[model samples]
Target: MKTGSTYLQFLAAAALAGQVVSAETIAQINGNKYLSPYNGKNVTNVNGLVTAKGPSGIWIRSTAPDSDERSSESVYVFDRNFGKNLTVGDVIQLNGTVTEYRSSKAYVYLTEIINPKLVQKISSGSAATPRVIGKDTLSPPNKAFSALDNGDVFGVPNNVSLISVSNPTLVPRNYGMDFWESLSGELVTVKSAHALTKPNNYGDTWVVGDWKVTGLNSRGGLTTVDKDANPEAIIIGSPLDGSKNPAITRVGDTLGDITGIVSYSFGYYTILPLTALNVVKAIEPRLPPPTTLISSGDCSGLTVGSYNVENLWAGSAHLVNISDHIVNYLRSPNLIFVQEIQDNNGETNDAVVTANLTLTTLTSAISSIGGPEYEFVEIDPVDDKDGGAPGGNIRQAYLYNPDILQLRKPNFGASTEANEVLPGPELKYNPGRIDPQNPAWTASRKPLVAEFETLDGKNSFFTINVHFGSKGGSSSIEGDARPPVNGGVEDRQEQMELTANFVADILAEDKNANIIVAGDFNEFAFVEPLENFLAISNLRDMDEAANIPQLERYTYLFDMNSQELDHMYISQALKPKAQYEHVHINTWVTLAEQISDHDPSVAKLNVCKK
Candidate 1:
């Protein structure tokens, strides 16, 4: 009999010999978890078939795939030079170290083999066919984004933990992220793909295929209904064969079929196509008819509108288009709450802090189009104090038809002066900033409060125009962080609290005050900040009051979902007779026809009913 130490050494040597004799398959290298089990380990003689070759490297698929649905049969090899001698349908074996790669912490890692060396080309001339995503292969799950998100991807206190660290097993049939992760590096084809958004600057287009999807609007684009963000959609990135993608594609346009390699880049899972995709069916260039909620032309009814003009300057070329949208599509509401009105000099940091010229130019354009000759009121922000494009000094303003509405008390306050509600349910300053010195408004636009009345001064109501802090610094929805970070949420919450308190003071003075709070809140209605604001202020969202269908209530389109960023809220007094419509002038048109990223909205209310 041998000693115990000698016996252990013999067992270790036997195991090492077994490892040297066995070759790893692609499925074995990619385990069921988010991270590979063999990460950071050097392996020899990995066998696969060369599926596709691009400028970066080649994709290889296992000849003998396992029955595990969670394990991908293909993977990318990151070697810029090694793929030059390779071609599709060549069976090969390679030696490399398994690595998990991501450009930053905000993105999920792509399982890859780096520093690869081709050991053998086993065979060539075999057929390389891509698996059809929704037909022959498994379809992407439609409901949830990630199981790691605890049922709500937009919940607060985000970035609490990372999916990378947890490395949970994938549930490919339920979660969207898991479904895509299961096919990480596979060659797949999307059939009858329809564009979900306009192509980005890099020519990447978001699209949903013939697969079953939820929240599909009548316009052939997906909308955010309830908790679903439409995870069945995927983005089509640049072509691997180095061709230019169509730049003028619009939402609802069709790209017939796409065959590409599934990969992750720029915080989203994308398909790098084999060649450029052309628009097989182009959408019509006509815009939807103007809103039906026209002005009542008297104190019996009030027609109000809200739009974020996207940093309008006095001499911007798109002024005519924007004026046309406001006149024809929005029906030229009696009062319009507009945001992003830049200074007269337009983005010059020379201490010129007035927007009179910009507002006049827009009003003149509207009048020239046979629309209302609107009068405007605003408090110019301190030079460069507001956060937007640097030196832009964007602020919120009111554009009202003087024949229908007028300022109740024409006392405009200075930029930094805080407005207060007095005993008469009136603002101390007619058009004033709301709590400008508060930390919540730091580097953000302050709320503009103005008291309005019918031309006869018989019925009075209050309006607050707000452009809250933006959603900058937010993490990607498909990022590693669970319940991804919503940047500026805390500040938005504080800002909402202050605005609600101001509303409370008005209610405290007169419980039946007719107040209409509207503008770009910069947060979704279902999110925490807006929810808290609605809860505290007792303001009703006009969309609900108007009974707009759940699928049609959107004013902006981004990524894979058509969502609402501009909103109009009403006090309890105006909720009884509010009617609203979202004019889809921008969202339904091609990117070249869009004057602003946001679509304008119109609402008709009976402010004098009570």
Candidate 2:
């Protein structure tokens, strides 16, 4: 080991000014002034020694990369609002003062780091000066590499995953304690323990033995307040020749090694010093994509658009409702989802309901626009006795251009609230709708799902459409609100949530699977039901592309006022493939008398490989 008066001076000078350090503390720690305290004045300038962390959110940067830039500044964030604006590959530094925070571990905190840059150079007398070390260089240690990937700990092999010991018992009882005590004030390599398969919030790479040393130099004392029940670390410096365990010795000009059993489990793994690590270098664990069905459409990368076609329901016996709204979605659906289809009896979709052709009627209409290649998937028709509003007891349904997408496995299931108990004769005979938990009445108009092979015959996700209970306010306006499905706005909210939860349950089955939920929810974009849906599920609303401007946002108009009631939520699994985005909101009336109370929404989606 190299000795230090001049070496210590160089490092200390580089630390932020105002920092308080004991005369003996090393000077060259992370000294960027922009660190926490957000205070315009630099407190670290005075104190040479300030507490920091083992390193998770650590940062390093060029002190002054430009004339306008200060000698020290870094980026850090504790605020949620600002975090939302951040994007991938953004290079930033912290600025706030150091403060304790609960993360994977509870270690030291340095806030307010900013002015991100790499590779800084130093000018004479300038904080810009580089930290210097005089230790004689050595060659890297040569040992077979080992990688650890058990549920308990994982890392790249060789450098960061090595462990010193695995003994169930120790001689001094906790002899490791004595080792640590002897190695205080020494420079040691430590892996952040929190990265282990199991780690506490306090990040610390479990201790490996001290760096093996030969031709021993003096090992200093460490005065750490180790409140931890079992502390583990690797000491770098040494009073090591005397220890009962094997000692490491420098053999190469830049590397060192110790003779010990290579762990069948952990040695050969790479272990790094937290303060000296880079985040981008950290690899996040992942699950292989689903193996069942596959989606080959690059639709996520194409100009994709989505919209809700208002009120296409089965009404009065033979009059199946069909709207001009859905005419545009025929031949090009990577996947299409829509809502609001009413039915009579168990007959639904295009089946004969109340002599009214619902799915069958609309299927004809959609085929007119999309050509014969179009088809549909829907929930079993339900009997809504106590006539619900406009679309009757409309729930959800869809029309699709099958040529673009084929399903791997479409989990078509019912919603979660099926009791069909509105009030009066209008709903007296009406049956309830989807409620996943109630297997007793799965036939209710629930989400319709069908997996298909694209015309090219590749895999894809099935789309579900919904027109949740409208804002009938405190009671079902058309008929007196019944007991079960009638808690007023609360019930409507609850039902939608049930639907969302039901869908989430499916996604949870395999988070990597791609899914999309679309239709006229009848609730505002920011309403609780929609918000909760987004929260619990790994899905994001594509509405934002149009939501930025109110005019661009308004889709379904009621009484002539525009509101963002229609929606399209896509799974995060497909986020990386999303390429095109558009919303064609047809809210105006043509010479032909307008069909329904709501407008039709349309989107063209594209997914592609980079």
Candidate 3:
């Protein structure tokens, strides 16, 4: 694809980096194809039959390798057409020219497809349109059937977006799939629909209700009849062919493409000769912008990032957009932590509500990130909110890189001091969680803690994150404020003190152990109890290391000014010089209105022993 000196220089540099391959050699490509140039000449215009195609390129196993070892033969393929026609058992006698890439790898710049039998032409097939009901439409199964009797829900949706069938022509259905799986979502031109709907820009007519999901060569959506949770059975795949998969799609509406037809038997929905997806058409789906975030890209750098989870409900719908937004920044950072995650509440029509936070929702959101190498960790607060927006009183949470922070110890139970303070006539949780013994023992939201074998040291430090009593005022907003009896600001202060004491106790056992207490304190820098407690003790507030003007010390922005309510305090040990730093105080300003009442407080410093 190059045409000049600039291109030649690029090729020379790539050669230096050991990526440029201007040679005649034989190496294993995609499956086992050869990479030798035509007639020993470094040829770029080599053409051939498509043995296979994939995201990695095409598969063209060298026919010249030792007959016994296929892998040894090498899978030759072209960078541009390698992954084409990729599928699980798709083999063909491809006649494409061989080429080398990166190093000694073989590839094909496929010229023609020797085997076009991959397609199962819908022989001017005319299938009956299934019946539709309610605002939602139901239809006949993709393939014919005696009767589809399942739970209350059965039949594909009548979405006008992707399932177009109108008098006017529509764009070719762009299904990201391969030639291998005939059942995978695809697009075939039907001469005319017995019945039609509206039309989209791409000559796509909305096939309301249901139409036959033909192309029986690949996967079928049916399943082995069963009464259990089965994603494999429910998968019809949105194909990103429609207005792209809705970022806020339901938990059950997953994006998938199978290679074979699915079938149900013995009361269970199942796949006949089960076929999972192996390749996706490289075509990008067309979709709209998410509700909040606008244009997105890798956040500044990949170290750490932030999100509101559409009000902290981890299960909140439409988080997919935010997910893709965050992935842009995931290449780095061995760890990630989030705030405002709420649990799933069945009482509400929408199980994933943003008003409150939950563990299940957040865990699910993070797990969807897609890289197997990435692991997850989170703290489930015993008490979410009292009941309103934050009715459960859900606290802030943290997630770390297990690869970087191996868990040494984790404490979810309250300390002995807490158990003793209760009973003795002070049943604080009265009509609700009246423990009678330890009213204060209930974990409304305890700071998440873990001992990580920090990458910089032998012994690990206790990393703790918390979202103290909500609401801003000194006492009015405090859930730990006044209980009428012997509880007031003093009791609230004691709760915080109790948590701090626990940390001190932990360090006392191993004085050399480093510790980090980070999160929204709810209390400002001027609060006597808040500042004195942390200052009176030897603990060091990370603000000192910031070295920025006091004006920049704040983390919570109100009106036009920011507040110091959010804090990150590290041990005094790494003060003078801790290697890297990117607290980048003004980063939140870029957030503008989408900003949470709370601002993100980040620090990039590795603590060490003097």
lDDT of 3 by residue, 1-610 (tens): 1135664455445434432222221222222211122321222222222332333334332323333221222233434333443443343333232222221011112111111122221122223121121111222233221111122111111111111011111111211000101111111111111111111122221121123433211111111111111111122222221222222221112223222122111121212212222212211121212222121112121133233233455444545533443443233244445555555552343433332234444434555775213344453334433222444334344555544554543323322212111222111211111121233333334445545554444544556555554542221110111110111234335446755665566455555556666665655544444655575445776666656444445434321123455666666654454322223222222232232444343455454343
lDDT of 3: 0.32
Q: lDDT (0-100) at residue 225 of candidate 1? A: 68
The model with the greatest TM-score is 1
Q: Please, what are the lDDT tens digits per residue for candidate 1 over residues 50-152?
A: 8888887899999988889889999998767788988899998888767787878889999987667789999999888898997767889998888777888
What lDDT does the true structure give each of the candidates? 0.87, 0.33, 0.32
Q: Poorest 10 consecutive residues of model 3 by lDDT?
A: 476-485
TM-score of each model, in listed order:
0.95, 0.39, 0.39
Query: What would the C-alpha RMSD of candidate 3 be, to one decimal place?
Result: 25.9
Q: How close is candidate 1 to the true structure, as a TM-score?
A: 0.95
Q: How far is candidate 1 from the true structure (C-alpha RMSD, Å)?
A: 6.5
lDDT-better candidate, 1 vs 3: 1
